[model samples]
Target: MTNSRPVVNKPEIDFSDPDWKRHFQEDFDKQFSLPHLRDILAIKPRPTTFSLKSRIPLDDGDGAATGSWNGYVNDDDRALLKVIKFASPTSAGAECIDPDCSWVEQWVHRAGPRKQIYFEPREVKAGIVTCGGLCPGLNDVIRQIVLTLEKYGVKNIVGIPYGYRGFSDEGLSEVPLSRKVVQNINLAGGSFLGVSRGGPSTSDIVDNIQAKRIDMLFVLGGDGTHAGALAIHNECRTRKLKVSVVCVPKTIDNDILLMDKTFGFDTAVEEAQRVINSAYVEARSAYHGIGLVKLMGRSSGFIAMHASLSSGQIDICLIPEVPFNLEGPNGVLQHLEHLIKTKGNAVVCVAEGAGQDYLHKSNTTDASGNVVLSDIGVHIQQQVHVH
Candidate 1:
């Protein structure tokens, strides 16, 4: 029998206790384990001469080529993505209570080329699709995947048009892909394969995959799109299909937990900053003027916060994470009154999803099923005019 319970749930063990190592290992092995295709397909992995084992390292600043690089990430090569709750998040001084578990610290795998691969490159048919709203660096990501597959000697590469719809829609067809076809795609915005919202059923998509004999599927999308991808993968797995599904998370909001940032976040922040700066100029030019700029951040406030920080001219920043009032004594209106009286003008930056309570909540959703947010910017403007 094994103690499969999380280490945090059990009584705290003394630091001097010799059994700490054994106890920690039990939780890590069972609770934080990652899955592998080798076990799923029950197939032995083959040694990969990925890019012929001679790919150039990113650090080679002098444009020097590497000879037979040995940079294949392995199972032992893991990282700490999910940090256990050693202490309450607010206790700044509290971190890693059980520091003695040194061996358990070497967890999670780094992203890179693996020394062993499951699929045969020449015979592999790779399919790529982009779903959800457009974001920065999508084309770059697509181009990179295509080039990497080409380097691995995969000749039959195809792009799925207009997201999951491509598989079911008769008008949408698979676009043949190659190195030459994707060569300057990175210079452009949006995806070469195009993007769309909620499309055909996962079962139908899998049917197409089986029909087309797609060996590997690469999905690029936001959180909702990622869930759809996982559902598709699970369906394929249940059918015992020999297909590998890979996803590259791309959210302009950068809301994914335990992950650093998402693609296009920087671009979103930079564009928001520019808008805030413009608002600042307009506010300062008028007498008792108010400049209001709204940024994109439906749930998270990374875009609004970062843009406000980057643009020094913003006097107030409203984010979705923080609830604010407009009419009370301590509300935004009162604050604006003070700023107008003292400073004569002020620039306020807000997230699109901020202060939703002040507006109507409709059950309506978008093409991707995301709730269409009420216009907080317009609401704020109207409130200011009324006051």
Candidate 2:
């Protein structure tokens, strides 16, 4: 089978053309744009009561909003794209895109509290669901959402237990939520509402939303869960139902696009550093020893890369972004041998999703429809033993 890289035949235009700027700006805006309520329904917004800036101790929850809350983000506010373009020998972005390599200012809609909200705070019944696997800051995220909604004067807020399963599960029920209820929930790790994988169909979920009379829904999860939220949004729109679906993305893998970083990424990297240190100690203690640390990164290698960089003890770090071979004159096995001969010991860190191309492909998937990854860590360990 051929593993040749597919050629991207980009339609070329003169870089000096004055219209290129306009074209680029339009394309960029289209890519990062979010749909507003006006796009679907012509609902007039109500002034938000999220003006709580002065209360030093947040639980005081009394009296009128200070209104002096310096700024409320307007719909037109945009955040400049902060991440640098990562180019390599194969991906020479600057050389290919422009001879000057200068980029036009890239902006995305800034996230924060808005002065006017589409839903009437008191009349709105909000539902929150945390889906997929647990992450480090799920409870904190839930607590913040509840607190923010309370600040907006929302009276009816409920948690959908165990991800989307609560939507159609025969026995599951919604848990009433409030600022007081979720005040200390952040002290705990994992999701306060718990989480599950795949659940009932989107149609079934929307049906439950209608039955529960939920006007606003906050969905927290990774890619698959976000896809489900999008489906729910479309289903609600198709039925001409007045429902707003907001997704607060969550994942430890740091795989989300157009985002600087996700909530759980820093924590994951910090935890992985400790593990790498342990591996280093273990390897250093033995003669010609090798310590292999396998980390979790289902899609991206942020944890493995950051942890290795932070620990400074890892001799080699393997990630999905860069390719490596297990066997050859210039393969990983050769490098390990070189390290053993020179350094007497080595510490290697690998991301779980790395080196999947070498494995036999599987059609099996987990409950969330995520592909069941072959154990690359165990394979590397076995190869090390044999070598």
Candidate 3:
């Protein structure tokens, strides 16, 4: 009778032996020293048609030829508005602290040129650094910055790799960014230079800026990143370094104070809508089944609200802005049970920061100094399963 067991092959040599290590090192050294190997690993720099000396005139009179709205602002009254000064209110919901305060509606206009020309075109050496979480249009924004700088005849542009940490890194390596390199980067998502949480000291960043001779620094991130940038700018000012720091707000939650919307918010909502649709289908297929979909939102409910509205199939929506009970008569669980009884199924959408009151808060924080949020989604899942 033939043997039915499978035959196994054994190695002739043991890789754990010191002889194997020596042999591997010898082979590696020999292969790496070859000229053909070095040539294969070398990266070629991208070519560009534009030169630093080439100037693209801002006022080329193309707006008049194209019948565009370029010089329309010149026709308006040019007066600068005075900054608004607010006094502290004694009570909440009061507009002013003084009871006898008089309201005045003064619309101050610009008295001089609205746009101030700061940096010269060709002399500008721009640096871009992206920090924090991934956003959809990061690459698009990077591409636009590079293209705009190139248009202004600014040839020296470098992208700092891996957030503020790049400033204090041992080698302090930065990628050379130009119109040619960033032309097709917008076709992809996320940042090409990469991103990370936490940052180096403000002095370190300022030192790197001074060392690199970067006149313009563009920081792309949310609130935490902006705060760091502000510190860096202050340090630069203290040192009398001539550097212009600009921030581009990037948050998928759309929680930035003055901004109406963020770049990735719409994309996030659109993607969440698809997940809600799938969850709704699953819920409808079973008797009295409940489908729960959780979205990204820390302190705000913008993503949850927009996703729920766009989905239209969500029976219950919960967010961090509002607190909801889980066990009361009017609680979420009770409401979901009632809905299941009436409609035979239920679908719920929740933000990640929702129902924080129900979970145990951990005394921990992330690298960005944000308090670690409990997983409300898993908590809700466990509660639902138990009920």
User: All candidates: CA RMSD in angstroms?
Assistant: 6.3, 4.7, 22.5
The candidate scoring highest on TM-score is 2
Whole-model lDDT, candidate 2? 0.83
lDDT of 1 by residue, 204-307 (tens): 99999999999999999988898998898889888888888898988998887545788799999898888888888889999999999988889878888888
**How does each model score on TM-score?**
0.85, 0.89, 0.74
Distance (Å) between predicted and true CA of 387, model 3?
Answer: 2.5
lDDT of 2 by residue, 1-387 (tens): 111122232366456787875776688699778866677787886566565464232332232334454566878999766334534325543322444444556678988877666776778899999999989999899998888777777889999999999998888999999888999999998888989999999999999999999999999999999999999998988888899899988889888876668889899999999999998999999999999999999767888998999999998899998899999998898899999999999999999999999887789999889999998888998899998
lDDT of 3 by residue, 249-292 (tens): 99988887535588888899999999999999999998888999
For TM-score, candidate 1 versus 2, the one ahead is: 2
Off by over 4 Å in 2: 1-9, 12-17, 52-69, 83-96
Winner by lDDT: 2
List runs of model 1 lying over 4 Å from the truth. 1-32, 52-69, 82-107
Order of all candidates by lDDT, from best down to worst? 2, 1, 3
Assess candidate 3 and give its TM-score to the true structure: 0.74
Error of 3 at 171 (Å): 4.4
Candidates 1 and 2, the one with greater lDDT: 2
TM-score of 2: 0.89
